[model samples]
Target: MPNGEERPISYASRSLTKAEVNYAQIEKEALGIVFGVRKFHQYLYERRFTLMTDHKPLVKIFGPKTNLPAMAAVRIHRWSVELCAYQYDIQYKRSEDHGNADMLSRLPDGQEQETEEEKVCFSYINDMPVSAADIAKETKKDQTLSKVLQFTLNGWPSHTEDTRLKPYFQRKEEITVDAGVLQWGIRVIIPATFRKQLLNELHENHLGINKTKAIARSYVYWPNLDDDIEAMIKD
Candidate 1:
């Protein structure tokens, strides 16, 4: 169509899987466009094209520099990276002007069925079910972890040779607290997000409860951590 011919090049449409259906409208739209490019990479890769969508926020996101808001999840960040493989201009089109895409979006498809093996491989239960708010609250109660959380969120103080939190200071840049959730690199701080999952990993391997407690102590700390690990293993 770059040559001005009315003829089309490629077309594709498919119902999103269950996980995708739960995405916000902006995420869904961005995914659809990204999927389209991937599906037609032979035609789209290295070639300039215009990706029209009804979501205006997508325009800003795909721009050269993006100040992703706090509400933007890591999922959005991943999707943005996936979109970088192509050269395209994201333009907003009115819903009325968006024709076939609107109809395809409404086309119903059956839910995806997952096998038993899939279930075993993917347990949705999070190990640490703690929220950012809970992390903040807990930090206020514990002087040590609170200092660690604050140091991770804000900048750590200079000169900490005598401090017990020397290890944290050494790796301060890699550790961060975003949206009240402390993260050590990509792995969330186990205090709240993946506590249960980590415990299960230890228990499933029959790593003795004491060993698990030792492992937790080396990297992280919270009140009753040993008790929590023991309970998870018992379950």
Candidate 2:
């Protein structure tokens, strides 16, 4: 204790996927954590890892079963089934106690890599009755909903106007019918990285057809476009 404050001896942490993504470190961490699990479990066919963590929900989930009816039970049950091949003992500690594991959690982003081994192990099915394709199909159907829309690396186009092109389509801030006559709308590139904002626009109903159209044009015309987004827009 620097000032005689008690410091924990165990460690606990969770890794964030969308934060500072450093490719090299991501590669290393990917190997150690994500891939390591796949490979480690592959050969052992049976083992229990002591996971140190301070995340309350994760602790309850990974810890032993309890009689209490909890939502976390669903999550834990799923984890238990998936990790059944290898035993996992979930234990708790102060965040300070779990320094080493926390370091793995803090290991600058991108250290987690996309590995072939993991892809194989984490593949669509094991004992589960459903295939990922089923869920994906549902998602695709949802996107195709007339009110809802779908956009991806491939798709979108053939519904845009010619005289006024909609080069892009993306989720955005919600729309709010303006006080004056400026009826709002939305326009975004099909494959939008700024999905949160785009979704907001839809929920709020702030942006309208015209604005959505303009945003589309801007996205299509952006420099990164490989082919003319305008051409694709009107497709």
Candidate 3:
């Protein structure tokens, strides 16, 4: 009965990683398309179907005949590569007209599963100066960070009087929790108890202030992170 009646077969959803949460709006839209295609790969791999999205620009970027620009973002290139394996056509529907997908996205089913991105985020734990478990446990013990973690997961309040949480509150949007450890845009938020030890490790090789700060900037974050590095060097 191919009478042009729309039907739903399956649904899937997952949360974004700390880094992904910071992607540009267009990038996020592109990611959603990739996520859906991948989630239903078994059903859609060899079959032809219409991929509908409210993000109009995607029509051009993902259309069957459009050539991806050489200056497009790396992520766009990667996602396009993934779509190359499948046979489908991309179309744009106005947001108001795409109520079903929009509503489902707004009220996604409640189920938590580790995504590949999170797995990659956790892969480097063994190489870190502090283990993920240590960070998680210490985070729970540190009153400020523990509170920050709770706020990040549950949702932050409009205002807070605690001076300790002020800095975190100011940047609440950037904070995220992964397996209990808090992170700020991919940088691990080191707990107070472990900062001293981590500082020692950073300074162990006498990498100097600039080098030390550069290394710390890449892997970890905390209040006054730069100041702490400077103080450790002076002391």
Q: Model 3 over residues 113-230: C-alpha lDDT tens digits?
A: 5457656766656778789989999999998998887777666788999999999887664465667877766678899998899899998989999999999987888888899999
Clashing pairs in 1: 127-194, 127-195, 127-196, 127-197, 128-192, 128-193, 128-194, 128-195
Question: Candidate 1 has what TM-score?
Answer: 0.45
Worst 10 residues of 3 by lDDT: 102-111
Selected candidate, larger TM-score, 1 vs 3? 3
Top lDDT hit: 3
User: Candidate 1: where are CA atoms >4 Å away?
Assistant: 1-8, 99-125, 129-235
Candidate 3, residue 184: Cα displacement in angstroms equals: 0.5
Instruction: Summarize candidate 2's per-residue lDDT along 1-235 as a digit string, tens digits.
Output: 5785544453223343332121222122222333334644554456555554454434543345633232111222444445555666756668666544444544443334443533452242332233334423333343232122222222334464432223222311111111110001211122223333333443354455455445444322222333333233334
Q: Which pairs in model 3 have colliding backbones?
A: none
The local distance difference test score of each candidate is 0.59, 0.34, 0.77
Candidate 2 local Cα displacement, residue 79, angstroms: 3.2
**Model 2, C-alpha of 68: deviation from truth (Å):** 8.9
Displacement of residue 80 (Cα, Å) in model 2 is: 3.7
